[model samples]
Target: MRKLLFEMAYDGSRYHGYQVQQNALSVAEVVQDAVEVVFKKREDIVGCSRTDAGVHASQYFFHMETALQIPPEAAVIALNNCLPGDIAMLSCTEIPPDKAADFHARYSVCWKEYVYKIWNSKVKNPFLQDRAYQVKYPVDAELLDRCAREFIGTHDFRGFCSAGAKPTENYTRTIYRAGVHREGDLIEFRVAGDGFLYNMVRIMVGTLLLAAEGKLKEGDVTRVLASLDREQAGITAPAAGLYLNWVSYTPFGEENPVK
Candidate 1:
Protein backbone atom coordinates (compact mmCIF):
# COMPACT_ATOMS: atom_id res chain seq x y z
CA MET A 1 0.00 0.00 0.00
CA ARG A 2 1.12 3.56 -0.69
CA LYS A 3 0.24 6.65 1.34
CA LEU A 4 -0.84 9.89 -0.28
CA LEU A 5 -1.30 13.36 1.13
CA PHE A 6 -3.84 15.66 -0.55
CA GLU A 7 -4.76 19.29 -0.31
CA MET A 8 -8.25 20.59 -0.99
CA ALA A 9 -10.60 23.46 -0.21
CA TYR A 10 -14.32 23.43 0.39
CA ASP A 11 -17.33 25.56 1.12
CA GLY A 12 -18.64 24.14 4.40
CA SER A 13 -21.98 25.95 4.28
CA ARG A 14 -23.80 22.76 3.32
CA TYR A 15 -21.97 20.17 5.38
CA HIS A 16 -22.20 19.36 9.07
CA GLY A 17 -18.43 19.48 9.55
CA TYR A 18 -15.22 17.96 8.31
CA GLN A 19 -15.60 14.61 10.05
CA VAL A 20 -18.13 11.88 9.38
CA GLN A 21 -21.48 12.00 11.21
CA GLN A 22 -24.16 9.38 11.89
CA ASN A 23 -26.96 10.80 9.70
CA ALA A 24 -25.61 14.07 8.37
CA LEU A 25 -23.62 15.02 5.30
CA SER A 26 -19.99 15.91 5.97
CA VAL A 27 -16.98 16.97 3.93
CA ALA A 28 -15.19 13.75 4.72
CA GLU A 29 -18.20 11.67 3.67
CA VAL A 30 -18.39 13.46 0.34
CA VAL A 31 -14.68 13.08 -0.21
CA GLN A 32 -14.94 9.39 0.61
CA ASP A 33 -17.72 9.03 -1.91
CA ALA A 34 -15.60 10.74 -4.53
CA VAL A 35 -12.74 8.45 -3.63
CA GLU A 36 -14.86 5.36 -4.15
CA VAL A 37 -15.92 6.64 -7.53
CA VAL A 38 -12.37 7.31 -8.62
CA PHE A 39 -10.53 4.37 -7.08
CA LYS A 40 -13.44 1.86 -7.20
CA LYS A 41 -13.12 1.27 -3.44
CA ARG A 42 -13.69 3.35 -0.35
CA GLU A 43 -10.66 4.40 1.65
CA ASP A 44 -10.64 6.00 5.08
CA ILE A 45 -9.12 9.47 5.08
CA VAL A 46 -7.71 11.37 8.04
CA GLY A 47 -8.31 15.10 8.04
CA CYS A 48 -6.05 17.79 9.46
CA SER A 49 -8.74 19.45 11.55
CA ARG A 50 -12.45 19.72 12.29
CA THR A 51 -14.48 22.77 11.41
CA ASP A 52 -18.00 23.60 12.51
CA ALA A 53 -20.87 24.12 10.09
CA GLY A 54 -20.79 27.23 7.90
CA VAL A 55 -17.05 27.55 8.40
CA HIS A 56 -14.99 27.50 5.20
CA ALA A 57 -11.48 26.33 4.45
CA SER A 58 -9.25 27.86 1.82
CA GLN A 59 -6.65 25.15 2.29
CA TYR A 60 -7.33 21.84 4.01
CA PHE A 61 -5.44 18.58 3.99
CA PHE A 62 -6.04 14.86 4.36
CA HIS A 63 -4.06 11.67 3.94
CA MET A 64 -5.04 8.14 3.04
CA GLU A 65 -3.42 4.78 2.45
CA THR A 66 -4.39 2.83 -0.62
CA ALA A 67 -3.19 -0.04 -2.74
CA LEU A 68 -4.07 1.73 -6.00
CA GLN A 69 -1.09 2.53 -8.20
CA ILE A 70 -2.56 5.71 -9.68
CA PRO A 71 0.08 8.43 -9.77
CA PRO A 72 -0.41 11.39 -7.43
CA GLU A 73 -1.04 13.85 -10.28
CA ALA A 74 -3.56 11.51 -11.87
CA ALA A 75 -5.27 11.00 -8.52
CA VAL A 76 -5.72 14.73 -8.07
CA ILE A 77 -7.36 15.06 -11.48
CA ALA A 78 -9.55 12.02 -10.92
CA LEU A 79 -10.66 13.22 -7.50
CA ASN A 80 -11.48 16.64 -8.83
CA ASN A 81 -13.59 15.13 -11.57
CA CYS A 82 -15.56 13.16 -8.98
CA LEU A 83 -15.97 15.91 -6.39
CA PRO A 84 -18.79 18.43 -6.40
CA GLY A 85 -18.34 22.06 -7.40
CA ASP A 86 -18.23 23.27 -3.80
CA ILE A 87 -15.12 21.21 -3.16
CA ALA A 88 -11.95 21.29 -5.24
CA MET A 89 -8.80 19.23 -5.11
CA LEU A 90 -5.63 21.25 -5.27
CA SER A 91 -2.64 18.94 -5.09
CA CYS A 92 -1.56 15.42 -4.20
CA THR A 93 1.75 13.92 -3.18
CA GLU A 94 2.88 10.43 -2.37
CA ILE A 95 4.57 10.11 0.99
CA PRO A 96 8.01 8.56 0.97
CA PRO A 97 7.84 4.95 2.11
CA ASP A 98 10.45 5.43 4.78
CA LYS A 99 8.66 8.34 6.57
CA ALA A 100 5.04 7.52 5.78
CA ALA A 101 4.58 5.71 9.09
CA ASP A 102 5.38 8.79 11.13
CA PHE A 103 3.37 11.29 9.03
CA HIS A 104 -0.17 12.12 10.15
CA ALA A 105 -2.74 14.53 8.81
CA ARG A 106 -3.48 16.04 12.20
CA TYR A 107 -0.68 15.11 14.56
CA SER A 108 2.09 16.23 12.23
CA VAL A 109 0.69 19.72 11.86
CA CYS A 110 2.90 22.44 13.37
CA TRP A 111 0.25 25.17 13.46
CA LYS A 112 -2.94 26.51 11.90
CA GLU A 113 -4.26 29.98 11.21
CA TYR A 114 -7.92 30.98 11.38
CA VAL A 115 -9.52 34.22 10.23
CA TYR A 116 -12.91 35.53 11.32
CA LYS A 117 -14.44 38.02 8.92
CA ILE A 118 -16.96 40.67 9.88
CA TRP A 119 -18.84 43.07 7.65
CA ASN A 120 -18.87 46.13 9.82
CA SER A 121 -21.56 48.31 8.32
CA LYS A 122 -25.19 49.29 8.67
CA VAL A 123 -25.96 47.79 5.28
CA LYS A 124 -24.93 44.18 4.97
CA ASN A 125 -23.35 43.24 1.67
CA PRO A 126 -25.49 40.74 -0.15
CA PHE A 127 -22.39 39.09 -1.56
CA LEU A 128 -21.09 38.23 1.89
CA GLN A 129 -24.38 37.04 3.36
CA ASP A 130 -23.13 33.56 4.12
CA ARG A 131 -19.44 34.36 3.88
CA ALA A 132 -19.07 36.86 6.71
CA TYR A 133 -20.73 37.93 9.93
CA GLN A 134 -22.71 41.15 9.67
CA VAL A 135 -22.27 43.48 12.58
CA LYS A 136 -24.49 46.53 12.20
CA TYR A 137 -22.31 48.69 14.35
CA PRO A 138 -19.21 50.79 14.11
CA VAL A 139 -16.33 48.47 14.96
CA ASP A 140 -13.00 50.00 15.74
CA ALA A 141 -10.72 47.54 14.02
CA GLU A 142 -7.61 49.46 14.98
CA LEU A 143 -8.40 49.28 18.66
CA LEU A 144 -9.15 45.58 18.47
CA ASP A 145 -5.87 45.05 16.62
CA ARG A 146 -3.99 46.57 19.52
CA CYS A 147 -5.93 44.51 22.05
CA ALA A 148 -5.35 41.29 20.12
CA ARG A 149 -1.64 41.28 20.98
CA GLU A 150 -2.48 40.23 24.54
CA PHE A 151 -3.30 36.73 23.31
CA ILE A 152 0.22 36.18 21.94
CA GLY A 153 1.85 33.68 24.33
CA THR A 154 1.36 30.34 26.02
CA HIS A 155 -1.64 30.22 28.33
CA ASP A 156 -4.34 27.97 29.68
CA PHE A 157 -7.20 28.65 27.29
CA ARG A 158 -9.96 26.85 29.15
CA GLY A 159 -11.79 30.16 29.64
CA PHE A 160 -11.99 30.78 25.92
CA CYS A 161 -13.19 27.31 25.02
CA SER A 162 -16.87 26.52 25.08
CA ALA A 163 -18.22 24.41 27.88
CA GLY A 164 -18.87 20.64 27.51
CA ALA A 165 -15.79 19.98 25.39
CA LYS A 166 -14.52 16.45 26.00
CA PRO A 167 -12.45 16.83 29.16
CA THR A 168 -8.91 17.61 28.09
CA GLU A 169 -6.01 17.63 30.53
CA ASN A 170 -3.96 20.21 28.70
CA TYR A 171 -5.44 23.62 27.97
CA THR A 172 -2.16 25.38 27.48
CA ARG A 173 -1.48 26.57 23.89
CA THR A 174 0.95 28.96 22.25
CA ILE A 175 -0.33 31.82 20.11
CA TYR A 176 2.25 33.01 17.65
CA ARG A 177 0.19 35.87 16.30
CA ALA A 178 -3.24 37.46 16.88
CA GLY A 179 -4.39 40.68 15.29
CA VAL A 180 -7.22 42.42 13.48
CA HIS A 181 -7.14 44.04 10.06
CA ARG A 182 -9.66 46.04 8.10
CA GLU A 183 -10.10 46.99 4.47
CA GLY A 184 -13.18 48.90 3.42
CA ASP A 185 -16.07 47.48 5.49
CA LEU A 186 -14.48 44.14 6.07
CA ILE A 187 -12.84 43.42 9.41
CA GLU A 188 -10.73 40.32 9.86
CA PHE A 189 -9.47 38.82 13.09
CA ARG A 190 -6.58 36.52 12.18
CA VAL A 191 -4.96 34.24 14.70
CA ALA A 192 -2.20 31.67 14.35
CA GLY A 193 -1.56 29.14 17.10
CA ASP A 194 0.20 25.88 17.78
CA GLY A 195 -3.12 24.30 18.74
CA PHE A 196 -6.62 25.37 19.62
CA LEU A 197 -9.45 24.26 21.86
CA TYR A 198 -13.12 24.08 20.85
CA ASN A 199 -14.44 27.43 19.70
CA MET A 200 -11.23 29.08 20.82
CA VAL A 201 -10.76 31.29 17.75
CA ARG A 202 -14.40 32.31 17.64
CA ILE A 203 -14.41 33.28 21.30
CA MET A 204 -11.21 35.24 20.83
CA VAL A 205 -12.84 37.22 18.01
CA GLY A 206 -15.90 37.82 20.18
CA THR A 207 -13.73 39.08 22.99
CA LEU A 208 -12.08 41.52 20.62
CA LEU A 209 -15.50 42.70 19.48
CA LEU A 210 -16.43 43.32 23.10
CA ALA A 211 -13.31 45.39 23.44
CA ALA A 212 -14.24 47.37 20.33
CA GLU A 213 -17.62 48.19 21.88
CA GLY A 214 -16.15 49.13 25.24
CA LYS A 215 -17.67 46.15 27.01
CA LEU A 216 -14.25 44.66 27.69
CA LYS A 217 -11.25 46.81 28.28
CA GLU A 218 -7.83 45.96 26.91
CA GLY A 219 -6.51 45.23 30.41
CA ASP A 220 -9.42 42.87 31.11
CA VAL A 221 -7.98 40.31 28.69
CA THR A 222 -5.13 39.59 31.09
CA ARG A 223 -7.67 39.28 33.87
CA VAL A 224 -9.69 36.82 31.81
CA LEU A 225 -6.59 34.74 31.13
CA ALA A 226 -5.63 34.83 34.79
CA SER A 227 -9.17 34.12 36.02
CA LEU A 228 -9.54 31.00 33.82
CA ASP A 229 -13.29 31.62 33.79
CA ARG A 230 -15.36 31.02 30.67
CA GLU A 231 -17.84 33.70 31.74
CA GLN A 232 -15.12 36.31 31.56
CA ALA A 233 -14.76 35.97 27.80
CA GLY A 234 -17.11 37.35 25.17
CA ILE A 235 -19.66 35.52 23.04
CA THR A 236 -18.70 32.88 20.49
CA ALA A 237 -18.53 34.58 17.11
CA PRO A 238 -20.81 33.11 14.47
CA ALA A 239 -19.32 30.21 12.56
CA ALA A 240 -20.21 31.76 9.21
CA GLY A 241 -17.44 34.27 9.66
CA LEU A 242 -14.73 31.79 10.44
CA TYR A 243 -12.30 30.37 7.88
CA LEU A 244 -9.41 27.99 8.16
CA ASN A 245 -7.11 30.40 6.42
CA TRP A 246 -4.03 28.22 6.19
CA VAL A 247 -2.10 25.46 7.89
CA SER A 248 1.61 24.85 8.25
CA TYR A 249 3.69 21.75 8.92
CA THR A 250 7.01 23.53 8.35
CA PRO A 251 9.11 24.58 11.29
CA PHE A 252 7.95 28.05 12.39
CA GLY A 253 10.49 30.83 12.49
CA GLU A 254 10.92 34.55 11.77
CA GLU A 255 11.50 33.71 8.10
CA ASN A 256 8.68 31.16 7.88
CA PRO A 257 6.21 32.33 10.53
CA VAL A 258 2.69 30.96 10.54
CA LYS A 259 0.52 33.11 8.31
Candidate 2:
Protein backbone atom coordinates (compact mmCIF):
# COMPACT_ATOMS: atom_id res chain seq x y z
CA MET A 1 0.00 0.00 0.00
CA ARG A 2 1.03 3.59 -0.64
CA LYS A 3 -0.07 6.79 1.05
CA LEU A 4 -1.36 9.52 -1.26
CA LEU A 5 -1.80 13.09 -0.09
CA PHE A 6 -4.15 15.37 -1.93
CA GLU A 7 -4.31 19.15 -1.68
CA MET A 8 -7.78 20.27 -2.68
CA ALA A 9 -9.93 23.37 -2.74
CA TYR A 10 -13.67 23.74 -2.88
CA ASP A 11 -16.48 26.29 -2.91
CA GLY A 12 -18.70 25.07 -0.08
CA SER A 13 -21.90 26.93 -0.87
CA ARG A 14 -23.69 23.90 -2.32
CA TYR A 15 -22.64 21.18 0.07
CA HIS A 16 -23.81 20.37 3.57
CA GLY A 17 -20.24 20.25 4.96
CA TYR A 18 -16.95 18.43 4.64
CA GLN A 19 -18.02 15.19 6.31
CA VAL A 20 -20.43 12.83 4.60
CA GLN A 21 -23.99 12.35 5.88
CA GLN A 22 -27.08 10.42 4.95
CA ASN A 23 -29.35 12.22 2.45
CA ALA A 24 -26.81 15.02 2.04
CA LEU A 25 -23.99 15.63 -0.42
CA SER A 26 -20.66 16.51 1.19
CA VAL A 27 -17.13 17.38 0.19
CA ALA A 28 -15.80 14.19 1.67
CA GLU A 29 -18.32 12.04 -0.11
CA VAL A 30 -17.56 13.69 -3.43
CA VAL A 31 -13.86 13.07 -3.06
CA GLN A 32 -14.39 9.55 -1.82
CA ASP A 33 -16.60 8.79 -4.80
CA ALA A 34 -13.91 10.03 -7.14
CA VAL A 35 -11.38 7.85 -5.38
CA GLU A 36 -13.64 4.86 -5.75
CA VAL A 37 -13.97 5.48 -9.47
CA VAL A 38 -10.19 5.56 -9.83
CA PHE A 39 -9.44 2.57 -7.59
CA LYS A 40 -12.67 0.56 -7.86
CA LYS A 41 -12.80 -0.04 -4.14
CA ARG A 42 -13.78 1.63 -0.92
CA GLU A 43 -11.08 3.98 0.32
CA ASP A 44 -10.58 5.79 3.57
CA ILE A 45 -9.84 9.47 3.12
CA VAL A 46 -8.94 11.35 6.29
CA GLY A 47 -9.38 15.12 6.25
CA CYS A 48 -7.35 17.57 8.25
CA SER A 49 -10.45 19.25 9.67
CA ARG A 50 -14.22 19.04 9.43
CA THR A 51 -15.48 22.44 8.28
CA ASP A 52 -19.10 23.23 9.18
CA ALA A 53 -21.89 23.61 6.68
CA GLY A 54 -21.60 26.55 4.23
CA VAL A 55 -17.96 27.04 5.19
CA HIS A 56 -15.30 26.98 2.49
CA ALA A 57 -11.67 25.95 2.18
CA SER A 58 -8.94 27.34 -0.05
CA GLN A 59 -6.24 24.88 0.89
CA TYR A 60 -7.57 21.71 2.46
CA PHE A 61 -5.71 18.42 2.69
CA PHE A 62 -6.53 14.74 3.05
CA HIS A 63 -4.66 11.43 2.97
CA MET A 64 -5.63 7.98 1.80
CA GLU A 65 -3.96 4.62 1.37
CA THR A 66 -4.16 3.09 -2.07
CA ALA A 67 -2.77 0.10 -3.85
CA LEU A 68 -2.63 1.89 -7.21
CA GLN A 69 0.85 2.78 -8.37
CA ILE A 70 -0.09 5.69 -10.63
CA PRO A 71 2.11 8.76 -10.70
CA PRO A 72 1.00 11.55 -8.38
CA GLU A 73 0.41 14.07 -11.17
CA ALA A 74 -1.58 11.60 -13.24
CA ALA A 75 -3.64 10.68 -10.20
CA VAL A 76 -4.45 14.34 -9.60
CA ILE A 77 -5.62 14.82 -13.15
CA ALA A 78 -7.70 11.66 -13.11
CA LEU A 79 -9.28 12.57 -9.77
CA ASN A 80 -10.16 16.03 -10.93
CA ASN A 81 -11.85 14.60 -14.00
CA CYS A 82 -14.01 12.47 -11.75
CA LEU A 83 -14.81 15.14 -9.13
CA PRO A 84 -17.62 17.61 -9.44
CA GLY A 85 -17.09 21.13 -10.74
CA ASP A 86 -17.25 22.67 -7.28
CA ILE A 87 -14.30 20.63 -6.02
CA ALA A 88 -10.82 20.53 -7.59
CA MET A 89 -7.60 18.84 -6.71
CA LEU A 90 -4.63 21.15 -6.88
CA SER A 91 -1.88 18.64 -6.33
CA CYS A 92 -1.06 15.15 -5.16
CA THR A 93 2.04 13.63 -3.65
CA GLU A 94 3.19 10.18 -2.68
CA ILE A 95 4.75 10.14 0.74
CA PRO A 96 6.38 7.36 2.72
CA PRO A 97 3.82 5.55 4.84
CA ASP A 98 5.71 6.64 7.93
CA LYS A 99 5.41 10.28 6.87
CA ALA A 100 1.65 9.85 6.64
CA ALA A 101 1.62 8.56 10.20
CA ASP A 102 3.81 11.46 11.32
CA PHE A 103 1.47 13.96 9.72
CA HIS A 104 -1.42 12.89 11.98
CA ALA A 105 0.40 11.92 15.16
CA ARG A 106 -0.18 13.95 18.29
CA TYR A 107 -2.13 16.75 16.51
CA SER A 108 1.21 18.45 15.93
CA VAL A 109 -0.27 21.20 13.80
CA CYS A 110 1.77 24.38 14.21
CA TRP A 111 -1.15 26.69 13.53
CA LYS A 112 -4.28 27.14 11.47
CA GLU A 113 -5.31 30.34 9.69
CA TYR A 114 -8.88 31.39 8.89
CA VAL A 115 -10.34 34.44 7.19
CA TYR A 116 -13.78 35.99 7.76
CA LYS A 117 -14.99 38.42 5.14
CA ILE A 118 -17.58 41.16 5.57
CA TRP A 119 -19.06 43.24 2.77
CA ASN A 120 -19.13 46.71 4.27
CA SER A 121 -20.88 48.69 1.60
CA LYS A 122 -24.27 50.26 1.14
CA VAL A 123 -24.92 48.03 -1.84
CA LYS A 124 -23.56 44.50 -1.75
CA ASN A 125 -21.36 43.33 -4.61
CA PRO A 126 -23.08 40.66 -6.65
CA PHE A 127 -19.84 38.81 -7.20
CA LEU A 128 -19.21 38.35 -3.49
CA GLN A 129 -22.80 38.06 -2.33
CA ASP A 130 -22.45 34.40 -1.51
CA ARG A 131 -18.88 34.54 -0.20
CA ALA A 132 -19.04 37.46 2.23
CA TYR A 133 -21.21 38.62 5.06
CA GLN A 134 -23.22 41.74 4.15
CA VAL A 135 -23.14 44.33 6.88
CA LYS A 136 -24.50 47.69 5.72
CA TYR A 137 -23.84 49.62 8.90
CA PRO A 138 -20.61 51.57 8.98
CA VAL A 139 -17.79 49.64 10.61
CA ASP A 140 -14.93 51.34 12.38
CA ALA A 141 -11.92 49.40 11.08
CA GLU A 142 -9.58 50.93 13.66
CA LEU A 143 -11.78 49.85 16.53
CA LEU A 144 -12.09 46.35 15.12
CA ASP A 145 -8.31 46.07 14.92
CA ARG A 146 -7.99 47.06 18.54
CA CYS A 147 -10.52 44.42 19.50
CA ALA A 148 -8.67 41.79 17.49
CA ARG A 149 -5.43 42.45 19.32
CA GLU A 150 -7.03 41.52 22.63
CA PHE A 151 -7.37 37.87 21.50
CA ILE A 152 -3.66 37.21 21.12
CA GLY A 153 -1.81 34.75 23.39
CA THR A 154 -3.15 32.13 25.74
CA HIS A 155 -6.51 32.71 27.38
CA ASP A 156 -9.60 30.87 28.50
CA PHE A 157 -11.74 31.17 25.38
CA ARG A 158 -14.89 29.64 26.78
CA GLY A 159 -16.86 32.82 26.14
CA PHE A 160 -15.75 32.98 22.50
CA CYS A 161 -16.78 29.39 21.74
CA SER A 162 -20.23 27.98 21.10
CA ALA A 163 -22.25 25.81 23.40
CA GLY A 164 -22.81 22.05 22.68
CA ALA A 165 -19.06 21.55 22.39
CA LYS A 166 -17.75 18.46 24.10
CA PRO A 167 -16.24 19.05 27.51
CA THR A 168 -12.53 19.65 27.61
CA GLU A 169 -10.14 20.03 30.50
CA ASN A 170 -8.48 23.09 28.96
CA TYR A 171 -10.06 25.92 27.04
CA THR A 172 -6.85 27.86 26.45
CA ARG A 173 -5.20 28.23 23.05
CA THR A 174 -2.48 30.49 21.73
CA ILE A 175 -3.27 33.07 19.09
CA TYR A 176 -0.14 33.63 17.07
CA ARG A 177 -1.70 36.51 15.21
CA ALA A 178 -5.06 38.26 14.89
CA GLY A 179 -5.91 41.29 12.81
CA VAL A 180 -8.81 43.08 11.16
CA HIS A 181 -8.24 44.93 7.95
CA ARG A 182 -10.12 46.23 4.95
CA GLU A 183 -9.72 46.19 1.17
CA GLY A 184 -12.05 48.53 -0.60
CA ASP A 185 -15.47 47.74 0.84
CA LEU A 186 -14.50 44.35 2.18
CA ILE A 187 -13.59 43.93 5.82
CA GLU A 188 -11.43 40.91 6.59
CA PHE A 189 -10.77 39.32 9.93
CA ARG A 190 -7.71 37.02 9.81
CA VAL A 191 -6.53 34.96 12.73
CA ALA A 192 -3.90 32.24 13.22
CA GLY A 193 -4.03 30.06 16.28
CA ASP A 194 -2.59 26.85 17.64
CA GLY A 195 -6.14 25.48 17.79
CA PHE A 196 -9.71 26.68 18.05
CA LEU A 197 -12.87 25.49 19.74
CA TYR A 198 -16.22 25.17 17.99
CA ASN A 199 -17.44 28.52 16.64
CA MET A 200 -14.58 30.32 18.36
CA VAL A 201 -13.35 32.29 15.37
CA ARG A 202 -16.85 33.25 14.28
CA ILE A 203 -17.75 34.40 17.77
CA MET A 204 -14.55 36.40 18.01
CA VAL A 205 -15.39 38.08 14.73
CA GLY A 206 -18.95 38.70 15.96
CA THR A 207 -17.65 40.32 19.13
CA LEU A 208 -15.34 42.49 17.08
CA LEU A 209 -18.24 43.46 14.83
CA LEU A 210 -20.17 44.58 17.90
CA ALA A 211 -17.26 46.82 18.77
CA ALA A 212 -17.16 48.12 15.22
CA GLU A 213 -20.86 48.95 15.37
CA GLY A 214 -20.50 50.66 18.77
CA LYS A 215 -22.75 48.09 20.43
CA LEU A 216 -19.94 46.77 22.63
CA LYS A 217 -17.30 48.73 24.45
CA GLU A 218 -13.65 48.49 23.36
CA GLY A 219 -12.70 46.71 26.60
CA ASP A 220 -15.62 44.31 26.41
CA VAL A 221 -13.44 41.67 24.78
CA THR A 222 -11.11 41.64 27.73
CA ARG A 223 -14.01 41.27 30.13
CA VAL A 224 -15.44 38.48 28.04
CA LEU A 225 -12.13 36.68 28.12
CA ALA A 226 -12.09 36.90 31.87
CA SER A 227 -15.70 35.83 32.20
CA LEU A 228 -15.13 32.38 30.68
CA ASP A 229 -18.85 32.23 30.01
CA ARG A 230 -20.34 31.73 26.55
CA GLU A 231 -23.29 34.05 27.15
CA GLN A 232 -21.04 37.06 27.47
CA ALA A 233 -19.87 36.86 23.87
CA GLY A 234 -21.57 38.21 20.80
CA ILE A 235 -23.71 36.20 18.42
CA THR A 236 -22.00 33.57 16.33
CA ALA A 237 -21.23 35.02 12.95
CA PRO A 238 -22.58 33.31 9.85
CA ALA A 239 -20.55 30.35 8.60
CA ALA A 240 -20.63 31.59 5.00
CA GLY A 241 -17.96 34.18 5.77
CA LEU A 242 -15.56 31.68 7.27
CA TYR A 243 -12.82 29.97 5.23
CA LEU A 244 -10.11 27.61 6.27
CA ASN A 245 -7.20 29.41 4.65
CA TRP A 246 -4.45 26.93 5.44
CA VAL A 247 -2.84 24.57 7.89
CA SER A 248 0.86 24.68 8.80
CA TYR A 249 3.01 21.85 9.98
CA THR A 250 6.62 21.49 10.98
CA PRO A 251 9.15 21.53 8.16
CA PHE A 252 9.42 18.15 6.45
CA GLY A 253 13.22 18.32 6.48
CA GLU A 254 13.32 18.51 10.25
CA GLU A 255 14.72 15.44 11.99
CA ASN A 256 12.08 13.12 13.33
CA PRO A 257 12.27 12.90 17.11
CA VAL A 258 11.15 9.29 17.14
CA LYS A 259 13.39 8.08 14.36
lDDT of each: 0.89, 0.84
Residue-level lDDT tens digits of model 2 in 1-259 = 8877788999899989999999998999999999999877879898878888899998888888888888999988999999989899998877666676666522645677899999998895889855889899889887898889889889989888777788888899889889999888899999988889989999998889879778787778888889998887888999889998977665323344221
Candidate 1, 1-111: lDDT as tens digits:
898899999988888888899999999999999999888898889999999988899999999999999998999999999999989999988888998998898998898
lDDT of 2 at 258: 22
Q: Assess candidate 2 and give its lDDT.
A: 0.84
Judging by TM-score against the true structure, name the best candidate: 1
TM-score of each: 0.96, 0.92
The TM-score of candidate 1 is 0.96
RMSD of each candidate?
1.9, 3.0
Which runs in model 2 stand beyond 4 Å of their true positions? 105-108, 251-259
The local lDDT score (0 to 100) that residue 252 gets in candidate 2 is 25
Q: Best-fitting candidate, measured by lDDT?
A: 1
